[model samples]
Target: MSFRDRTHAGRELALRLVERAGSGHLIDVLVLALPPGGVPVAAEVAGALHAPLDVLVAGEISTPVRPETAIGALVADDPPLYDRRSLAMMHLSEDRLGDVVVGERNELHRREYLYRGRRPLPSVNGRTVVLVDDGLTTGLTATAALRFLRRHGPTRLVLAIPVGNARTLSSLRDECDALVCLQQPPSLHAVGEWYEDFAPVSDTQVADTLHAFHATA
Candidate 1:
């Protein structure tokens, strides 16, 4: 079924996730969204679980030749950066690794400034963190987010999304403690294809959603 919008997708995905989670016991659990697409969906998930919502700043490094193809990803303030092997396995070019890194870093900085302002990042140490997104296609951003979460010492890391491609889902299975996705289409096109309304989420929308969720919590 095609989602009416990101908000509709979020509600549906959150219901499925809550069912899969098998309980509504997310007492201290945190929902970390990979913006700017992930924010709306993550807000719904956080609301459903009655959990605190946080933002995980990251960006995808798309291949120069194939802009739709993700070369790699970069997570802000994370150590033990992803290696070339990871990129190569994804069919990314090692020759353009430097360029990819530089571009991704610049985007990451802009995203961080736009979404975070002067607010400090939340602590995920020894807590159950539900990393959320609107959908997963290449899984590059999800991988980077998982790696960053690991470094921050989350007791359990769950990667959650509304929709995902089969290959991307398969690749991410072993990366996180658990994977919760609503749809996994075999012949995936783009992340926006499955939804009826897949508008590009803005930084202001993300901030407003975060604040609204926090206020209600």
Candidate 2:
């Protein structure tokens, strides 16, 4: 299965959500997207559900030795959440990741500012929170976002992605109240592989999505 674009995938996922929500799946939900890719998808979802849309900035921390591989994830202002498996594989430790964490944290904060401006993060307390991402591979960023959001006391924590690796989808099922994934291909590597037009999403695109959401909200 493949998507024409993020907008198309979002529309498809929104239909699934509507069906699921009718069967006691989602209620009083607040859509929180992992930008810059998730914004367009979540925008469609928020429009369909008539829910408020916001961003939960999450980023991967890559090691200097292997810049392409993510060793951990950075969410909010909390300490970076290390992928223990990845750490052990690279013969690394938490303390050794300090520099990488610092860099990723700075980058994540810069994005948070760029996307949301001076507006504070919306409250997820006592509400059903839907965490939307374009897709998942390692799921490290999703885990970090989930962990960080857990501190806010949401009534229910949901993971809603259009597609993901089969293994990752299996492991993540137990991590949240509901996991709404449209496709879980058994042999997957990158999220872009499942999309026909997986062009890079720019920072301006993300900001515009949020601006559009708030304009009619």
Candidate 3:
């Protein structure tokens, strides 16, 4: 399945979550989006579930050699979550990525502060937390977000995306209580390929989205 854009994919994803909500699968729901891409998609979901929306800033760590590849990820003030296998294959160690991690972490904090301002991350404890992203590739960023949310004592943790690779999605089952994806194709080269209008989301867009949500909320 393909989408017109993140908003379109989000609408489709929202329908399924609405079904789950109707069946009593979701309760005391709280939607946390991985900005800035996840913000638009998650707005649809928070609307459908009538839940409060928030942002969970996570960053991907990669080397200059192959910056497209995510060797690890991080969320908030937590330690970096690295893929040991990937590190071994790349012949690199955590120490080797220190500068990269520092840069990513700094950017992550900047986005978090921009999107949230003085507001602390909403209490996920005892709430059904739905972690939303536009799509999953290697799933490194989502995995990091999920692990951080898990440690926060959420009653039930869920990871939701519009599209992803079937194999990668299956491997992330243990990260959350429920995993929702609209399409899991045999092979997904990249997330943008599935979207007709895969535009770059800016920091201003992210802040505006959060501001709009908070205005009425």
- Winning model by lDDT: 3
TM-score of 1: 0.86
For candidate 2, lDDT tens digit of each residue in 1-217? 6899999999999999888778887889899999989998998899898899999999898877899888788898888878888899999999887877888888988999998889999999999999999999988899889988888899999999999988988888777888999998886788998899999999999998899888888
The TM-score between candidate 3 and the true structure equals: 0.97
Local distance difference test scores for all models: 0.80, 0.90, 0.92
Better of 1 and 2 by lDDT: 2
Q: Encode model 1's per-residue lDDT on 77-137: one tens digit a residue.
A: 5532444665666665556477667767887787777776777778999888999998887
What's model 2's lDDT at 148? 85
TM-score to native of every candidate shown: 0.86, 0.96, 0.97
- Cα-lDDT of candidate 3: 0.92
Question: Local error of candidate 3 at 190, Å?
Answer: 0.3
Clashing pairs in 1: none
Report RMSD (Å) for each prediction in the order shown: 2.9, 1.1, 0.9
lDDT (Cα, tens digit) per residue for candidate 3, span 1-217:
6899999998999999999999998999999999888999999999989999999999989888888788899999899989899999999999988988899889988888888998999999999999999998888889889989999899999899999889999999998999999999979988999999999999898888888889999
User: What residue pairs are clashing in model 2?
Assistant: none
In model 3, which runs have C-alpha deviations exceeding 4 angstroms? none
**Could you arrange the candidates by lDDT from highest to lowest?**
3, 2, 1
Lowest lDDT block of 10, candidate 1: 77-86
